[model samples]
Target: MRLSRSLAFAALFLLSLTTASVAGPGRITLPAEVTATGQVIRLGDIAVLEGPATAALGDLTLGPAPAAGESRTLEGARVLDALRRAGADLAAITYTIPPVIRVRRASQEVSEAAVRQILEGFLAEALGAGAADAELKSVELPGPIRIPAGPYTARVVPPADRPLLGRVRLGLEFTVEDRPVKSVWVTADIGVYGPVVVATRAVARGDTLAAADLTTERRDLSQTGRSVLTDTVDAAGRIARAPLVPYTPVRRDQLVLPADIHRGDVVLLVAERGRLRITAPGEAREDGTRGQQVHVLNRLSRKDLVGHVVDGSTVAVDF
Candidate 1:
């Protein structure tokens, strides 16, 4: 009877040794709060590795990740219970537990208009003066995109040419309140209108401009330069500096006042003050346009005098 009892006791002791060896002797510390990647809790993810944590976690398992905003707790008793389940020895091991666990979710649902406003502001800044007459026409979206509910910033990557008039494709980027995060490609349409001078017909170089030769056309002036002529009267009676193509926008510098006086032409030079008038016969020394000062040789005195051109054959000098 004594021998049988000794053998049974020895067997029980061996079993306990085996259990302790499987659990090991490392200690684990849990964090107060952590972000959950999915619906399952990972012991390794939250475990604070202060000392021998790796070895103590042998075969330890925490089942099913937490859902978003979910909470859990790990007290001293709970830590011991988990370790015991994993076959870790209680006497040799130590562990720390968090008072409470809180879940942090990364995404939220936001409205479509909020995003649209951000894009609109960004596009306006990108267009500069081009947006003066321009307006946001439409935004082509591919169904609903993934934007969470929160304050975010946006910017645009315009095409090689800016002030994108009409339809254009651009790159848009979004950031979570000062932190850069996401990007998307979208198509947009812009409506733009401004006054511009258009050639009504083909005009040869040096041709004197008439009202019928040009007209004002409302067109997309986002990409147009400010120097483009916008009024027909501003260009009427001016000489074309270059050949103009029909239906093309005319530039302000492309035309000048037509010359009304030619070199060597006979002109009547007159000086008048309060109806006191003096007239002289003069020969034009240079081509002169209306409002231009030109030199002329007085026939009787045979002296050169400067006079303002009044018409094709007349000049006025203030004596």
Candidate 2:
């Protein structure tokens, strides 16, 4: 009976040793404070793991990391619960240290000057070939921005509805690892220089513009409220609708097309009904450009009519 008891006791001791070897001498130590550089906090980030079984648990994700320039605290109990959920053998592992852990995410600041430089480059690219003569009058930023410590890309989004010249507002977007983190508004004043037509001499309202009457000059097109004529050919032979002073920019709206048909001139009145056409001699009562409607008197019928001016001497009428 004594020999059988000894054999059973020895067997039990050997089994215990085998079980300990399988579980491993696992140990975990938590620090009071930690810093994280990634987007998420991992077990290894806040805790030191010893032994084979516990070392593997270090890769387990704890939770989302705090935003840059910010910190968050985690409790010991919560961490233990997470470990337990991850199927960690609690009874076989030993833990040492803090009841709570504080974690801070590493960050960096984007300076105002850097932002201005970025916007300048963006503006230059937006202007394309015209950027060579473009001037940046002013740049306004919303101040510095803080973000996670890592490489990032910045994109300047211009307003799609209009051009980038004059006082313009743009959106500045920062993306890290292909994920958008923040956005800001930036404003700038831009001036684009280009040639514009200017009146060389005082031009009356009814005076026709001639090559000698207008000249080209370089000016800031942004300040011009109306679209200015760029070439003398666009203004030549066109009648002025408003009085233009010398050395002043000539705008497209200030000019009108020369009259094609004048009052009291004889015109060929044409009428079309189905495929049949009729023609009569008529007298125009009002000056009009081609395609303009004018009052006319048909000589054959001696009746008043309104017709579209086709040319300097022809008008079309509907019967």
lDDT of candidate 1 over 140-223, digit per residue (tens): 765555443356666778889755776778777776656555577777777678888988899999998899888888887655
RMSD of candidates 1 onward, in order: 12.2, 9.3
- Error in Å for residue 9 of model 2: 40
Q: Per-model C-alpha lDDT, please?
A: 0.72, 0.88
TM of each candidate vs. truth: 0.42, 0.75
- Stretches of candidate 2 above 4 Å error? 1-35, 46-58, 69-73, 86-104, 297-306
Cα miss at 306, model 1 (Å)? Answer: 7.2
Judged by whole-model lDDT over C-alpha atoms, candidate 1 comes out at 0.72
Q: Tell me the tens digit of each residue's lDDT in model 2 across 129-200.
A: 889878888888777688888898899999999787888898989888787878889888888888889999
Off by over 4 Å in 1: 1-119, 122-132, 135-150, 153-191, 265-283, 290-319
- Candidate 2: 10-residue stretch with minimal lDDT: 18-27
- Candidate 2 residue pairs in clash (backbone atoms < 3 Å): none
